[model samples]
Target: MARTRQPEVSNDVTRLITQIRAMIGKGEELPPERLLADQLKVKRHRLRLALETMRDAAELPRPIIRRNDSPVLKSDVVVQGTNALEVIELRIVLEPAIARLAAVRASPVQIAKILEAATTPQGVTRTIGDIAFHKLLADSSGNQLAASLYAFLRRVGSDHRLHVPTASAITSERIQQRDQEHRAIAEAIAARSPDAAEQAMRQHLRRVQREIADRLNPLETA
Candidate 1:
């Protein structure tokens, strides 16, 4: 199958991603960006790009933050049902455009419903209803076929826990960021600007993908 059009990283960066995948899989912390860059024989900029494009490594500078209370999310069930990479690939193809369409076509009721689904009420388990946001986006897009397909994807995601976000990614800072992103999406939809809505949605999805990588790698500052 053809590869997805993700970050325009060089082959060297791609190789570095694979190498880091191994290190992370083995429960190793990623080296500093400078050291990792040197080890990969790539420029620091290229290394950063690879890390950002690959996910969690971009946020390594923040801190690894081990929590006895909150376990990092890793969906072996979802991974068993289907490839993690494939789920991301599928989302990259379907979601941004669904957001775009929702912006242009969503009724006021649909918009309210979307915002409702995206926000969890106080005391609700954060992990539940993870698919509601994207699923609502598809349904609001005024495309029945797309909505049906997204429903199937939603089932796959919910059944396998693929839609759940990592525990750390829901930190106060990250929550603020998500709220801003969601606000941007809602504003764009209200304004009926497909372009902005699409962009905002894509950014949100990309961030989630990166968070997944971070959970897998759990790279700490070195």
Candidate 2:
């Protein structure tokens, strides 16, 4: 029997997989397909074949295509199924560490961005500012994996549907307090005080948890 030769695409797919694995190991997000194909010196069609191979092998998370043909992560569905409290509890565990790392690792430019994000602009929803502030901290953590994970967490946490039950609890006073907490965390990171950053982040999350719990308990009683 003669040995069979694999198609050229098989080799290209293997190369693509190897490169993607390297990027993952380095805690970097996969680049856009066109840019990645260019970088790998592979044709777009070959890149698509490589992606299909990975997907078939269950090597990649199944992507849900939106109306715009954007791929949303499978984990997003799981997050959407979970309640807000669960999301906040996870944030309590993850964000303090992120803030600590940001304090230690954030560049001056990142610090400035963090500070800017900390303040909610007039006529803008505080929720948007809050998300931006925390996201900046995550991005500043100098760990791309952590940053990516936080982005997922943020998306779920910010989903209005998840927080509808506690929406009434978000008063002007509470928003002010939350903004103050954001500022505190930003200041700690700006000062490069890891301990302070960690503590501030923990305190802020705990306060949010408490408020949500207070609201939920009343609803349950009713």
lDDT of 1 by residue, 1-222 (tens): 998875466787778788875554333446788888888788898877767765432212222345475534444444566855567667877888888999988877678766765654455444433454555577678777677667555555555444444545456666556656776777788788999999998888788777666665565511
Give the C-alpha lDDT of model 2: 0.77
- State candidate 2's TM-score: 0.63
> Residue 215 error for model 2, in Å?
1.8
Score every model by TM-score.
Answer: 0.55, 0.63
Task: State in Å the error of residue 218, model 1.
Answer: 2.9
Determine which window of 10 residues in candidate 1 has minimal summed lDDT. Answer: 56-65
Candidate 2 Cα RMSD (Å): 12.6
Q: What's the count of clashing pairs in each model shown?
A: 0, 0
Lowest-sum lDDT 10-residue window in model 2: 57-66
